[model samples]
Target chain A: MVIEKIKESRFTPDVFDITTFGTAFADHMLLSWYKDGKWSEPIIKPYGKLDFTPAISVGHYGQGIFEGMKAYKGETGDVYLFRPDKNLERLNKSAERLDMPQIPEEIFMDGLKALIDLDRQWVPSTYGMSLYLRPVMFATEEAITARSSNEYLFAILTAVAPNYYNKPLSVKVADRYSRAANGGVGFAKAAGNYAGSFYPTHLAREEGYDQVIWTDDATHTFIEEAGTMNVFVRINDKLITAPTSERILDGVTRRSMIELAKAEGIDVEVRKVTVEEMHTAHKNGQLKEVFGVGTAVVVNNYVAVGYASERLELEDLPETESYGKILKKKLVDLQMGISEDPFGWRLKVEENLVEA
Target chain B: MVIEKIKESRFTPDVFDITTFGTAFADHMLLSWYKDGKWSEPIIKPYGKLDFTPAISVGHYGQGIFEGMKAYKGETGDVYLFRPDKNLERLNKSAERLDMPQIPEEIFMDGLKALIDLDRQWVPSTYGMSLYLRPVMFATEEAITARSSNEYLFAILTAVAPNYYNKPLSVKVADRYSRAANGGVGFAKAAGNYAGSFYPTHLAREEGYDQVIWTDDATHTFIEEAGTMNVFVRINDKLITAPTSERILDGVTRRSMIELAKAEGIDVEVRKVTVEEMHTAHKNGQLKEVFGVGTAVVVNNYVAVGYASERLELEDLPETESYGKILKKKLVDLQMGISEDPFGWRLKVEENLVEA
Candidate 1:
């Protein structure tokens, strides 16, 4: 029988209990501070709300960065992190964009593993459920100089979730507004990038769409990622997705899909894709499927896309959201150490973590 | 004597009295929600913590907007707001970009006035000091969806003694990065627009400069605002600023400066000014002064600039910085109702506002 420890997570947990959000915290969270021109030694402590100011640059100015990953429950109850290095790498990229000092990759990954190991049992056994991990960084400085803050705060939280997507999505291709430009933060998953899209995405939803697929700013011709996911467009016999730029997020799932496609000997074209090309292909019976891939949903298949006065309903693709099911199964198996580690992905969670 | 209100803000007064960041607050805060497809009635209630999910659309998607303004204390203890209608108008424009419903200008302005009138003692009177008002709106819906949130929270707060600038600035004409693009939300003062520039601004600061004058995204030719303030460049004799675009924030101070310039017969030209033109003028001594005008600091004059690798020393034009100084004094006098209201810009506070 699994037993829960009474004391706080001192080093690691003898047992774990499942919970959602940041409510159920591991005993130890990795923290490091930078001040007077240098970063300090990292410390691990209990999860709780760190003191924050309303004037904290991150709170008001939106100088915040966050990364989300999941720890999965295998049949043997071993927790595992899928492509954690990618999340850490992306977090650093975001930190750089926000003028935040980046935590070394080794420290970032090491911190994540330590936190997960201490809270491994929080990983749910439900097929779709997992422990959602969030690593966040923000300017903790009280000054409102409208310049880069000198001090910052970084934190990690966990949430147990069944799925991010409710069902198959129906999105709209934004033909007028743009999420980012050539020299914007669209490439980084910065806090402000997400906040800017709120009003537009609200408008798109009012029009009865799930989300808006943002395009290039100058000309809304090239297709970009849906607000939450990098897009994958499958035409007949070929998979084509827009190549990322400074205005698009560098999604880890996007890279993984490319590797999976290449391994399957499928031709994957990474280039600019125009909406007109897809509309033409749809009319010519060449458009096969369009879906989204991200850490949240793995693959959220799209059934429809509304653009410029017409709704493109993709029928005969999969009555059910297909790619998500197939890819998710493969992804989970690969993450849980039960599948052929073809890509050499997945970091196994330590089974017996001894607390001091 | 001012009486302290109890349990009014979400925080205790001591939080503000002793905190290093914006962790403290006054008792009461305004709450206005947008639900049932429209904005709800505005309420002033206790300021408190808002419970939120990490996956909240605002947290992930960045569905947020904010406005910055201030209340000034006159020599006679009367309170005044400086052209607050402009902030309301800009907030609406930002709301439209994010697809959030607009709060009628009267309602917004009324709410701000009521808040200040109720807490007039919070308004400090130190020179170069006043209560800095921050009105912000954010997505509050809890879920993992890509579209905008159905619910939102709009509130206002104030900070005292914000010394926004400390020294003369060294600016760089943004050569590689752009703040906003054509047909983008640049003019709206949307939260994300500022978020995107933090890193690039940091990069500029690291290069021994204070801020970067963002250029157009399509072509990095025309000079836009200095991210936070509108750029006013004096070429020998004339005042030149870039014409506003969809990506350039239409600063209230920028417009007011134009009006003030026209009143003074300064021969202001609101058109595209290139980095090359600036370089050429600097080499020939045609460049006189470069300063920024905004709510904070009022005026931040630059003494130098770097274009690619060439640096321009603009200290010779001592006259342009003086233009900002004189204009700042004139604007302050007008706002406080101590000077001529040639433009009818001041909105005087209602008498006995605290009686209610």
Candidate 2:
């Protein structure tokens, strides 16, 4: 295993303020190959472009999978991966759904840490900022057949994101359109899942909305997810969210919220949440809070909702002890190592832990 | 109009292959831009790969729309396009669905004729094959936001394909997945639509099958398209197919077949086709022919269907004078100018049309 502790062949780092979206390569990158039958031994190498042809499968067909996570730079300058295991689990799920090879977690983590160690300075010190890490797997086979390719490549990219947004956002209830359906690959973070939302998202933006809320495919009646976030509705005192099924993406932050809610003695219901029920709750003035949970934004607070033809103003939606705010604090505290380990969620990188 | 005609920036006459897919380029390509609020001027230029980045939304997010048409080298070597208007209409429909700017029918046809006159020899002399033309549009903006990009590129490619399949093959009735749903992007020729099918098609290949018969999202009750090819079932001497909906792609070839069936006085029913009905037909021996219709494969014949732990053998299924085969021949003859087309489907491109 020590022999596998490889070094980057090219180690040049640059500092730029070009709003950094996916072009800056770190010193090293994770590499794995799938051929014959299984994934090869994962290797970490210099983060250079892999000499891709213009005719690659990902170019013609969107045969790609990606996992987005963050490495936090604590107040003490210690770096930690917040629930990296969850990211890895989701990556494997996405790979399975896309028919791409599942990467072994050990190699995934090892390569990620190696890349992070090489580009530690790129991690920003801003309060809300973290180094956004993107691990991607894609079809490398160049055959023009409309089937799964025999070859694939996996790599990781890191970029410093100062802040996802300026403040809490307004959201809409899904009046129409769906993200994924039952027996679809919504549970996995497949690239197709993300690609399909762009059009509707654009329409939402045109309608003066930042993101969209997706409903169930069968009837468009039940509330599902919003873009990539798992939605929560606080009605009458319970933190209620739709249950994770084939249609809903099993969000990591959504799960963390459920656990924190239970731990803090707040009522949480993971069940089918209907738009009609929410409309009724709004009518009754019991719809206290409606927010979304995801890795990119943590708990994004929401202030308004769009039902059929009218907008429901949820201006006073937050509770005295708001679940979204509390969950965000608890989640960040665990990520930053201020809280005691209750769920064993955080994975402290080797250099982060002090020697006894 | 003559100035627009002499705006000659097309390809030279000889740079084409007798047998290759997407390797040959037409002399000129049509271009249109969507800016400020509407589509810009349409221009014709020498065919080339438009400049793009690795992270262009199309390359990463599968933001592409495409249409397939063919210019036929007639029996007398006269060149023509079969239903260029249909392709343009479908293209605009797809564009609207994907939020892409519509290509004006006049510009689209003008561009086609320009390319056809420039590269008429590329239209095959062979019988089973034709010049496969691909018109594609994609997001060119370098933004990573999950909304529609402000910039885009559109290009058309020419390819000569000899045979759609090495052999006729089997397709599996999708027991595990659905391709697209109601209020989904399935009706459009969205690039993401193809990406989603790669995995299930891979599984079908593993099970000694070629394609998957996608079903409705809520229940795998009704038989939809064959992922790419539109499914047409000959049941009890009637040509039955699933009605076009948001969940089903409105294929140009499929539509043509329905129209052709009417002219041929063949019983054609464009309605909901249930899996149970197909199975019962096979059992009672009323199922005649099951085939697929698309631009790549004009009529792809299927002989069997597979499901979970059970393979329903349609080998004993009856055969008919395939509406699939008849329409294919009619379509080919019309393009080839050997048969009369009352519908004005063929567009003559070569100046030598009168001499031929």
Candidate 3:
């Protein structure tokens, strides 16, 4: 691979702060081009403004997709990436849904690894601090027709940030609006899916809730997901989550937690979870914990669930031995290389790993 | 309004063709900036590229809204705009739905008229030709949080094009995927609303249809708009269409058509038209004509409607005395100043209008 490096660094590293997420960029970024049924070799260049006319298809027709993953530094000098292959697979899935060309494994994996390796100094060494990797693919063709563009631009950006959530969240059950519908692009991390969710989420925030728990678009009866994360509900000692479908995102974190719980001999139910059933469970004092799981925050505990005029409060779960805390600890330990790799989930970079 | 005019134009006049809808832009574009709770004075500059950082909110969270309108050249070298006030009003309404700042009437109207008058030659003089005006506004603030941005960029680009559709279209009734849900941004002319419909429309096109007639998300029972335009059904000499709600765009062309039909002694019914009702009407041989109305294409006749294994064909309506033909003619005549402006719909450009 022929990679181009900048002469001097333009970015100065600062302490990672969780409050300011996605605000800074590293000194360099990886960019690759696709045209005429072929992709050019990836190159790392200085992070600066890109030249794009106003008529780009991604700006008008919304044919952009992205993926979110993290790279962590272990206590000794080892660097690890948590299931990067899964994120790359999901990125291709999103591309397929948007009528875009699928990215090859060499470009998606090698480009990301090489970019991270070159900027290894940006990776934080402190505990619970990691580099957030954003891999984006968008249409670069300058036309306004309602069709897919032939030209595309793919790039990866990294930001060093701490954990997103510091406390448990309060959520409301959405009764009016929906995030995505049946047979829609909700499963993919399409850019437009995030855009339509802002207004409803803002309404929930004004109502003193941290986020909204979306239900199915057909009847608003069955639970779907939180806009940014997959949701999990605990009834009795069984963990119940909605199955991965066209209406729900196949989150990597959610999948890992499900695996960890089942491996620990816990009963995990991946079926249709209805809001009415959850209300009934809360009424009977059987619904114990509800948390949102995603790459940003592995497990965000929900302290209150509001539906209409009723509220189900589980304020004591954060301090207790809840599933969210347990799964979060296990997930972080595995990510930071503090615990044994039971399922071989961590992939070590070439330079940082010390041979046993 | 401290306007800035470009010293020279980089664009050359090109032939108007329907196939090249938004390919070429005119000489100058209108631009306005919003910051610190105020909008800057409008300006007109040479149509060129725009500088935006990768972290802009619109590219990440989708805080973008737009409006589509047109300008026509009259017989004696006069340029006219049809119902521009309504377009400006709808643009602000869309802004309100997306949680963005509303564009003041002075800036939106005055800036648009000034820009069009300065580039009057771009307005095609042929009978069925017009300059398509696209007014777009997007978030410009560089941040990653899922909230509204403090800065915004509003610009208008013009392209001379003939009618969008030359022949009547064949549309499919969406049975599985949805365009918008209840209490969503469907009515806002939002960019994301257009993005989500592309994949489903692509599927419909592969099945030999030009567009998809979106149904209500909850039941798929009631017929909504056709994703891009407002739909109308004519049964037994009466024109029936779905009422505008949060689920449908309140199109300016649709409102003009309704007024024109009422003036022509035609009964226009604005109510919920269910799929079952339309199917029964078609089966009983009462469905006469179906057309779509919007600013892009004044009135697009539907030659066939496909639902499941059934196809209701109306191929002969274009040659017959169909209401779509009559309404389209009336609209174009009124826009080009060939017919009297009964409702005062046409606004003449100040420099192009001759004193009567």
Best by TM-score: 3
Q: lDDT per model, in order?
A: 0.71, 0.71, 0.81
Interface RMSD (C-alpha) of each candidate?
Answer: 4.0, 3.5, 2.0
Give the alpha carbon lDDT tens digit for every residue of B27-119 in model 2.
445666556656566665555444443345554556667777777787787887777777888888877767667776666776567666666
DockQ of each: 0.35, 0.30, 0.51
Tens-place lDDT per residue, model 2, A165-226, is 55677766656677786777777776666667777777776776778889987788888898
Query: For model 2 chain B, where is the 10-residue window of minimal lDDT?
Result: B1-10
Model 2 clashing residue pairs (backbone): B10-B27, B11-B27
- Comparing only chain B with the true structure, the TM-scores of all models are 0.90, 0.88, 0.95
- Tell me the spans in candidate 1 whose CA falls farther than 4 Å from its real position: A1-53, A105-107, A318-329, A354-356, B1-60, B99-111, B114-129, B139-153, B315-326, B350-352
Quote the positional error of residue B186 for candidate 3 in Å.
Answer: 1.8
lDDT of 2 at A23: 43
**CA shift at B318, candidate 1, in angstroms?**
5.4
